[model samples]
Target: MTFSIVGRCPETGQLGIAISSSSIAVGARCPWARAGVGVVATQNVTLPALGPQVLDLLEHDQLEPAAAVERALNANGWSEYRQVTTIDAQGRTAFFTGKEALGVHHALAGEQCVAAGNMLASIEVTAAMVHAFENAAGLLADRLLAAMHAATDAGGEAGPVHSAALKIVGDHTWPIADLRVDWADEDPIGQLDTLWQAYRPQMQDYLTRALNPTLAPSYGVPGDE
Candidate 1:
């Protein structure tokens, strides 16, 4: 039982995924992205390796989103048990909802985003998420957060969402933003939003420290000033 959105910032060539689930540790299992490559979300029986396999196709074969998704699915024997979405660096989107999908399933695609869900309260959840992402302002992460909230508002999974995550990749090989609530008894989405707000302002500062400590902002915590 999960809902997710895979998106790209066409202007900045950034890729991201926002997801929440009734399952535990959705962040570690469902979302995957590589800087300057693409993003993929694998759920609905959750074949985690399929995410990297799709990325491999996109990066090595230089395949488009559609081809990458197709080949990745074909390589798996349980295609009908998995649901996946892919978006290449160019913002092209593609998805597959298998025959054995749980509960109700919906997949909606907008400009450079795809929102999908299974065991949802309503099929309209994905549509609302996609619309919110398309219209949300600010950075790609902002749009992804908007999508996450929209999904909750429209009707999330059939049950309460216990874990939520946001994964984003920009110019670095590692994710520039990887925030997660491994488990939350209440309002994991709201918890994730709070984390984003606190993390956003210092994001550049952390990067600066990694790239050039001399230019990094102060730690603001100890005797050193």
Candidate 2:
């Protein structure tokens, strides 16, 4: 009941994932990324732990995306019910769609990205996502958002998606952008886009505050006045 794209910005080495699902709070369980490591999207009977486990292998163990995915599945008894995709820092990609995955499932691996979907309106959903991500020009987040929009436009989940998420990590351990519409009555993707627009200008500010509060600008809060 989910579709997602994981991509890397070659210019900045940023990793990002955008996803939407028929389930609520999909963001909390599906996407994971570590700066300078990789990104993972685990869904369809998702083992949330698998997301971090894959990243650990990619980052600490120096495993490529495919090898990390292989090791991850080798360690799990429930691999047959899962759908996962990983994109490493070097843009190496790997994906698995279990036979037990619900409904129609498909995946696409591209230059610096991977897209996957289960319980989709059609297998073409993943393809559309990949195309949009590769062709779109702009910030990494915007390209990711475009891919999510394309997925929905090309027939996303088998049912209406109630939640959406966009996550990106740059050089820092913290995410440069993390936006989610945990449950929305309307279009979760659109809501996520709005959140990104609102957050983008402050993204560098927040990072600066974290790395050097002395040089950080005002908070624009009442106390700062």
Candidate 3:
């Protein structure tokens, strides 16, 4: 019971992913991304290895997103029960929804974007998410958030969405901005969008301080540097 969108920011060249699910702690289980690398969302039955497997394939110069997905699925015997999407550093994207996944499961893949979900209201939910990401402006995370919002508006997970997450990676291959809003009283997607916007300025300030140390704007200088 999940809907997820994974995409690369054409503006910032940053890789990002956003996910929401009817399940508990979806943030910890669904989205996986590495800066300057790629992104993977392993849902459905959920095999944790798919996350690193995409990185391994991409590291070996597996440029085609479809090929990398094939390699990952083949390596994992439980593929029939999994739904996965992988977007490489070059913005090549791929997705697969397993046969045994819940009813109404589907996958959509496109340049720099992939959207997938199971037990959703309709294929329209996942498709809307993809369309929103493809057409939306702003950073990868923002696009992803828009996708999530669209999916929720279309009826998400065929039930309530309890947990949500956003992940953006920087040059260091570590999550420069990782935020998760797990479980909301009602309208979790709206809450997720609000959280992202509210935190966006602080995130921008943090990265600004890190990158533009010479200026040292009002947000204070980067101590990590």
- Candidate 3 local accuracy as lDDT? 0.82
TM-score of each: 0.97, 0.97, 0.88
Candidate 2, residue 11: the lDDT equals 99
**Candidate 2 — which pairs collide?**
none
Residue-wise lDDT of candidate 3 within 1-225, one digit each (tens)? 888888887667788889888777788877888777788999988887888887778877655777877888898887889999988788888888878998789888866788999998899987898889889888777888889888878877777778888888867656877888788767777777888888887876667667787754563446544
Q: Give the 10-residue window scoring lowest on summed lDDT in candidate 2.
A: 216-225
In angstroms, the error of model 2 at 71 is 1.2
- Which residue segments of model 1 deviate by more than 4 Å? 222-225
lDDT by residue (64-140, candidate 2, tens digit) is 88888888987986898999998988889999988899999998998799999999999989899999999999999
Off by over 4 Å in 3: 61-63, 208-225
| Model 2 alpha-carbon drift over 4 Å, by segment | none
Better of 1 and 3 by TM-score: 1
